[model samples]
Target: MKIERIEEYDERFEKDIIDQHGAYVINDETYAFQVLDRDTCRVTFSNRNDLNEAIEEYRFFGGHISCFVDQNGKILKEYDKVSFFDMKLEDIYVSQFYVSEEKIKRLLPYVKEFLIPVAKIDGKMVSLDGHTRMKIAQLKGISHVNCYYEEAGDYAKDFMEEAQQRGIFHVYDMPLLSKEEYEEKWHRFCDDFFEQRKAL
Candidate 1:
């Protein structure tokens, strides 16, 4: 899908989000929760009430909401929450972006004998997203990796470009796929591996 690029500092979308307060209706019933700034976009919220219950969750989890963009670059009616779940050891794939020579040296030994819960993303998974836990898993040989199934759409490219422009190294690119393609591949992978699954 093609998407028009909006220049940095464009206030239109930001204004729209803010005008709607903390929640913007994407479609008839689907809504995207808005946080005031970038820092608050990374937190995981188990429920909508979680946003009001704590400042940290509001700041981190409510920050950036995901929405589909049409070819015209207008935000579409459907959107998704960014989330992940623990997967068994064998189903996870090590990201090419995060795989460095030193990381390899450190990670391989643990991979040999245990299941480690690393974050897997089919789209641009930010460095700040789960960098700490991944490092700890690498060093400690922890079991169960958190896998983020890439949500297919053009939004990830924009997010990645913005991230790069801001000098965020932890956010890295993944192969783009449409939403249907992503779901198909994920189901195929799950069936092939016979692994237990949960959605975050």
Candidate 2:
């Protein structure tokens, strides 16, 4: 339900192993969850389909998620900051039209974990943040990416509606722009939108 720890990247030190708590593992490595219960169970994910079941278990695990570990205690992926599960890229809708090419390139190297943020809005999965990172993963031909749900406020619906009107339904519809153009366009648009809201 929340993030409490990010397992070290390939450290596997003797002091790091939580030998008693339940964790979600891929190839027998612990990726998430290290709670108070020593009797907690470990879930292995050999198939991507098992992710959903593991998520459900995480919701009820009675502890925060500890994402980062492989079956052999090697770190497979590290988000460093967020607790997220795997989600198909196609299921997430995007709100931005332009992603900075430079930013995308900088983030591409960190695509191994669920770093992009998404949220369920009106029963649909909407990209809450990290559009550039999501775009990078999509361009990398990655089918599944790591994502965490974000809690949105009342202003979110307005943002989604505006993006919808602009024909930005998915990440594919977004175009990568140079940093200068991205700032001039996207930043200007956000400023204008916020100003309009202030007037209201």
lDDT of 2 by residue, 35-103 (tens): 222223233344554455455545432222434344455543322344558888888887677888876
Instruction: Compare the candidates by TM-score and give the number of the best one.
Output: 2
Residue runs of model 1 more than 4 Å from their true location after superposition: 1-79, 97-133, 151-200
Clashing pairs in 2: 28-71, 29-70, 29-71, 33-66, 114-146
Task: Give the per-residue lDDT of model 1 (tens digit) for 15-125.
Answer: 333332333222122123343222122222233343333322222322234443333444433334545555543343332222223323332432322212232245433
Q: Pairs clashing in candidate 1?
A: 35-62, 40-59, 40-60, 43-60, 115-143, 117-144, 117-145, 118-145, 127-170, 127-171
Residue 70, candidate 1: alpha-carbon lDDT? 31
Scored by lDDT, the top model is 2
lDDT of 2 at 164: 84
lDDT computed for candidate 2: 0.59
* Model 1 residue 185 CA deviation in Å: 30
